[model samples]
Target: MLPGRTWTRLLVCLTCGGVACSDDSQGGHARAHYQETDHPVAGTLEPRSTWRWCYVHRRTV
Candidate 1:
């Protein structure tokens, strides 16, 4: 991990396969990526986390 980029939760962009840290971390890299690319959805990188979030609809899909 990069300095000052500690993260407990990670998210992977479904649209472009971009991986980033979740909002629970120092920087909301996932959300930032969504804002920049409008990727719409991302799934958690946590083990056994079979869930995804839709950034546009603001809910799980």
Candidate 2:
């Protein structure tokens, strides 16, 4: 495999921290993306997100 590609995958996983396991409408599979957030005043580093994936009416959203 390409080293760059592998490194990117690793970064994505690490950046997202832990992947939560659960049954969902997306065929039990889901992915996470980094989100830009700011609250209570901006800072050098962003805080952890409170977003998550779940099934809605048998569909992933």
Provide the TM-score for each candidate, comma-separated.
0.84, 0.19
Q: State, as a TM-score between 0 and 1, how close model 2 is to the true structure.
A: 0.19
Model 2: residue 48 alpha-carbon error in angstroms: 2.6
lDDT of 2 by residue, 1-61 (tens): 3333222111112333433222222322123222231111111122464333322233322
RMSD of each: 1.5, 12.5
After superposition, candidate 2 runs with Cα above 4 Å error: 6-46, 55-61
The lDDT per prediction is: 0.90, 0.25
Candidate 1 lowest-lDDT run of ten: 1-10
